[model samples]
Target: MPRFGSWLLAVCFFVSGGAFAGTTCPNFFIAGSAPTLDASLLSRTTEVCHTEYVLFASGVTKGPLYSAEHLTAAQIAGANSISRSGSWHQETGIPTADRSQSSDYTNSGYDRGHMTPAGDASTLTSEGETFSMANVVPQLHKLNAGEWEKIENYVRNIATQQGEVYVVTGPAFDPTTIPTIGKDNVAVPAYTWKAVYEPGVGAAAFLCTNADNYTCAVVSVDDVKTMSGVDPFPALSATMKSNPIGLTLP
Candidate 1:
């Protein structure tokens, strides 16, 4: 595994014709392209870029559609030393109506789960930014701290082993049901997923149910696209998207 210097490019992002702000922070994506959401689910979406990750927030869903990061071995090593920030707040960069406030999650019976785990932040500021409500979803308690946490740890470990990896994580919601929480009605997702891509190796995704059962499995990237309505690796080959590489689950 090769290592690269740990750095940060802090910027705000937005979708322009399905791409991210005309090449700003291109390294955060694979092949310099961002994911595309299915037409049906592409309304009032906001993209927010932080020091360590990029969040695609959904106005309708009141949570992140997904978060993207390019993790390197040096980055993970630096991140390991950062202290966790328990502070969670609203993303002011997003429109008032499109963002979730910390109060929305108060006693909502769901955890304010991070799409971009704070454990991956390499600095104190970045760690604090990870706590933004824009990068979170209403995740089930069991899944958030159980299998979900395991998956997060696994990805960081792989980043260390592979030198670097592209990670995209988000939630999947049932449009018809649309479970919600709090005064703001933050949407509760049916499932949460993480997709990991090693440059030369292949790609695979982890899907964990956001319910009492809290079951999780490794699935093809295409399966994740179909379920989440987002094509995370648009530049990835069809064969790679169709086939899932074997990954150890927790």
Candidate 2:
């Protein structure tokens, strides 16, 4: 894994509106291979690593395209022992013009939703890092607190039962038009999805619309890739992507 200090330095040199392809943070990806984003998302997007997760932050959307984690049962136990630290803040490593500020979400009627939920962090520091603006998106209050929250907990329960799992959570936007909130133009995604891969089992995803009357569905990993323009498990077999085991929704 690359040193966090070096990653911070690398982020400092990012040119505004430039594409950051070939960006990789292996520690947070499944099989040490990072997800590939569509060419259109490359510009103004860079990989940002945290203690418990890694995300590709998009300057255009002023939020993460996705946040990923290799979660273990032991880590979940550790996380359960720690209290949440609600210290939401902007990522200073990213250029000010390219990142969202906490103030931007103020009174925006949207919640600063976390792609990597705080409940997944195993320490106070990790939990705090999950609150970074780069790891957040503008989500409807009902969705964030309702179905989305259920999905997060469900993922954690699987990690506990299966010993470990690779999880990816992100927002999906429409190509033609994307709604926005706040001064930074943080994207209000039409949909948000969470995908999980268990080593001995199969891979599946939960797709949810970001609305007051939100509905969620169990889908294949390939379905997530097609919609979000990101293939989270590139190393997996075609069968794994094609046939997903049904994960019961809470």
Per-candidate TM equals: 0.90, 0.90
- What candidate 2 gets wrong by more than 4 Å, as runs, is 1-24
lDDT of 1 by residue, 1-250 (tens): 0110110011001222243222356779998888877765677887787888998888898998889999999889989887786598889978998888988888888888999999998888889999999999998788899999999999999999999999999988765577788777888887788999999999999988788777788888877776777778988999999888887797
lDDT of 2 by residue, 89-174 (tens): 88876777899998888999899899999999998888988989898888899989998898899889999999999998998876
Candidate closest to the true structure, highest lDDT? 1
Cα displacement (angstroms), candidate 1, residue 49, comes to 1.0
What overall lDDT, based on C-alpha atoms, would model 1 receive against the true structure? 0.82
Model 1 spans with C-alpha error above 4 angstroms:
1-23
Task: Report the number of clashing residue pairs per model.
Answer: 0, 0
RMSD of 1: 8.5
